[model samples]
Target: NITTDTLTIAGAGLISTAMSGDTLTISTTATADQNLWATFNADTGTTTANTTTDTLTVSGGTGISTSITGDILTITTPALLNVVEDGTPVLGGNLDVGASSLVKSTNVILSFSSGGEAAVNWTDISTALTGSGPIIRSVGADTNVDLVLDTKGTGDIDVSTNKIVNVVNPTANQDAATKNYVDTTTATTAQGTLADTALQNIVEDGSPQLGAQLDVAGNGLGDGTNLLLDFVEDASAVNHIEIENEATGSGPIIRAVGADTNIDLKLTPKGTGAISVADATNYETNVTADDDIPNKKFCDDTYAPLHDTINAQTGTTYTLVLTDDGKLVTMNNASANTLTIPTDASVAFPIGTRIDVMMIGVGVTTVTGDTGVTGCARLAEQGILIGRR
Candidate 1:
């Protein structure tokens, strides 16, 4: 097998100036200024005389059997092509790779790998293939597999490969809260414009469902599920998000819940700080305490009693301890007895002053008044009791 050896040009990347199964060293040095070019095996160890600034040509190499005339090289044999690294073998006519030919292929399958360590990040390619943006699939008239610019439609020749084209029209009320999707469309729908707005703008554009809120769907749900226009309030404030787990061993599946966010929160009684009872103390919850109130309770101290009683006395007792204050009297005796109020040098009470008396013993207790004193105006008694002027 005649294998083509690549000649390394002085640069940062692996670029070949020429390749052939021969001992060839292609090197370069800095020239002040000029575009540099080279020909492969052009001389064949023997130089040809080109007297003027004219075209030079190279002859056959490896899998190609050719002869150079003027500036063009023509293949003289039906060639067998092979991809030296990892790519589809390209040729002038139809590529014959081993026993297979790309002339009448319905589709071509390709995979990218970088030394089994990383994936080949496709940037530049040979002249045979070209395109860009929004993963596209073009079903041409011939329908033989080809990724050409503007392959899907007569629109802009988008060269970006990482894009999605609307292959079918999305169904109504089927999902995405009824958002238009590129993969669901039946025509050349520019998906980047629709999805670039993000989920929020999409929801904000449409009317929400009856008593429903728009939320990002999380958990195992696909990107499409994020558009599930149904946002349900989980509790008082939490809203769940739907996304995929992307966990190993689980493969790539849509999860129904990712996480949540809180809306608003409220307190119980709607007051700041706390209200608590102090030890062995009560609070005047209705009003603020004043000087007369002092906020002190009976448990701390007590006041003097307001009522008093004197036992039976043998002699007549007329002068009351409180001369001006009103008094009521009740008497009890072993036998018939009376307590009398004598009149002499006694300061008369106010006109409204009245006395009352009662006898529990078997004796009459009458309330008799002196000449200056008025008789009992309102009194209840059983015996002659005394009243003063």
Candidate 2:
């Protein structure tokens, strides 16, 4: 039993007390669970074990100072941020490293490595390739292959041999000859007995045809027909030039386009008021009573044989006189001798026509038995021009 007025507990914080006369017993087994103090009075209840053990632990609460066991909290500075595992961590978490930090499962395949030391910085291609060892290539040819180079550090580049290609350069060679070409070895050379003799004779006679021999048909020469006469436009066709002789009141009309119904182009009438047209029905005809134009006389007989119009001569002196003022005469001497024609010597010949005077005298000294020397002149009175010896 204990007797006291008041009881207080400090340090260990345990107390038991009773009123001045009331009995108080000290019991170690029973105690209050708080920081408390008790007072006893004469008439009040007895007090025992009023002060108790400190049971307000404050382990986890809003306003409390808590500490962890085995943790060195010696008022250290704040820590830097640490990368968390799968879960995100705030700024002040400890940097804890577990046993197998970065793990790839046994059954899983990893294409690339992770968590290695950073490579050294380098610029040269040889340095980079050497450092990264052999890299694994896709092993097959891919059309859209990409070349990825390390932009940051040294690394190797792996390429497939299938990606290589060959570059070809163009060259030229001689090919087959074309159609118009005459291959030198295969082209034919022409030769004939009679033809060669004829060609030699022509050359000796100073008359080699060569390529200049005119093609009678192709060149429209010596084809036995005049090319102009064959392609003559019909006089009756529109705009075709038509020749008409319309004399003013005369003979069975020379020729005309009827009386005068649009006779724009009319030929001047000839003398005698006559128009001897080949056909009277084909041409509209007329006549002029007194026309002054001369009527050209054309012989119906074919041109005279050139030999008949020519006469050979041996004498030296010859005189020529023009019968008509407008008549023309040509004397050609191919005898290789000087020819002198004695005109009045005062009569000046009109221009435009030629008066060819040649020398066909005895060849200075005549060569005996020369057939060509028995001279004769050649001429064409009308059309058949001839050369005579």
Candidate 3:
């Protein structure tokens, strides 16, 4: 049995009455003013009714509650003094809203309108704030973002203060010769090199006089001296030695009067005595009695058989009186002209005729046999006839 506050039943011209039971029941007949309420401990109270229609009002307190029986209920929450539309509100440690679904605010739901059709729709929250017009970004500050005008493929990247460095357009018929590099700061212009006939003609000299001193001298960097010729000998080694001809008859005569044109041999004695054709010369001698046997060898130490044969035509004779390597002396009588001896006189001469042509210190003295004849000969001992015929 709960007791409520007093009912202020004010009826005009009718008696308000209640049924006698454990629960009080009041009835309003017509145009009757009856209020059933409960007073709380601090002017905060609850009004509950057994019927479905419950009207409750509160003023100047923290909160109020009421119970009614309809599915459609109108809840009036106070307009918050400090309102943040989509802010989270906490009651101690629990969330005051959205225990079931994510609660979106009216601004969020209005922006979620897809073009124009609007129910409460969910949309993606952009992290950017909008201005009145279109959004813009700077090319330098925008990382990983590409502008629409960028080229399609990858190209070489370089730093450029001027225009972009590209493969300089190949000139007309451009090749390595036609392409050139220039330094613009110095204002130097480089004309491209080309291989043309005219270009070659500008510098080419086909037959150059090489080894000209102008070509090899004086371009710096090394030592240069022109030391070029000077090496061997020739035919005119001696001046006047005529050994070419003998038949000219102008050659020197042997042991005769006007034949002393060259050197002659006349024997002289070592001891002072008559040293003619007779001397004990420790050698052999030969004599022949003939009127034409011109005063030739009378006695000689060379002991040659042909010592008496000084009249041989163009032949050499020798008398081995002394060897040049031993204690030997030699005397030579040479003929210049070719001797014309008869052939029978050469056949009468013997091989071992003991007539001398050389001696150790003396010369020839006498002649014995006939003078021989020959064409060309060598003297094995030491006398002389004609040199050669």
Candidate 4:
């Protein structure tokens, strides 16, 4: 019922409109400086558009792609993309950064743990390295951290065929010394010659011959406190002389040690020089002097009669041995007994040897001589007999 002029189609510069009979027709057409599609910014502000090409393009950014197949639009992401939103990224395989360095901002720690053991942490401490197990650590201050190298079990850090250079001179007794320090401090002369100043550096030498007299000065030839000198034979230590210093006591020992069983320590004086023993203050008991240093027994036997050593005999006939000199012989037989004194050829008795005889039983004692004997005596009871050789 509507007429052509009475019905109108409104188009907002995108389509053309008209009315035909009972049908209202609308068709898209290009307007002045107008296109179907327009390029917009991120803020939804329209920027520019092409009038001839009114295509809406769907492009992709890095690690992404888009494709349109018929009426389907597909967007694809990267295949190796393991990262999730606000989470740690874990790769299925090894992460290889091609030709790039993996940089860290702080100290790196390499942690290790066994079945029942605590975790061992090895940390990089900028200038030095440290371990939580303290197997190897830096000792000293931060600026001058002393590196300590340690081994576990039979493990060894072997620097094969490589020389350790730039080593500082050792200060302590057990410290490691460098070649330069050893060469400079040990010797200044040629091959076999050793300088006098280098004597302090030589700890031990096999068959070391002194070029001059060794002057020990006030320090002497010892460790200053104990063992003064040691003499060894073919790597076997035999004797050592020790000087025992006393704090407040008067007795200090110059001890000579013979480091073996049943060994004699002898001090031989140079020809005809007497061994002078000074300060004979104290008396010693149960001591046997090898030399003829007179003891109490010798003094009593020579000067007194109260301490004569007795040689007791029980048989009827007894022979006087060399040990019977200066000793009393007592015969204790029930009958008469004969004391036979052998000649100097059989029993060589020294000159002026004297022997005393006593009859202890109800018997008579007679002192008889052997084949070439000179002195003889007969006594009814007890008497003294002196023999001369």
lDDT of 3 by residue, 45-161 (tens): 222245667655543345544444575444445665674664554467865556564435432212233333443333333223375422223223234544232454886444475
Off by over 4 Å in 1: 1-311, 314-330, 334-345, 348-358, 375-389
TM-score of each: 0.17, 0.16, 0.13, 0.27
lDDT of 4 by residue, 83-116 (tens): 4563544578997989984544533332222325
Which sequence of candidate numbers ranks them by TM-score, best first?
4, 1, 2, 3
- Model-by-model lDDT, in order? 0.41, 0.34, 0.34, 0.62
Q: Could you tell me how far off, in angstroms, the CA of residue 335 lies in candidate 3 after the best superposition?
A: 99
**Best prediction by lDDT:** 4
Best by TM-score: 4
Q: Weakest 10 consecutive residues, lDDT, candidate 1?
A: 298-307
Cα-based lDDT at residue 305, candidate 1? 17
Instruction: TM-score winner between 2 and 4, please give it.
Output: 4
Off by over 4 Å in 4: 1-201, 204-210, 220-225, 234-241, 259-261, 278-389
Q: Model 2 misses residue 369 by how many Å?
A: 33
TM-score of 1: 0.17
What's the CA error at residue 90 for candidate 2, in Å?
20
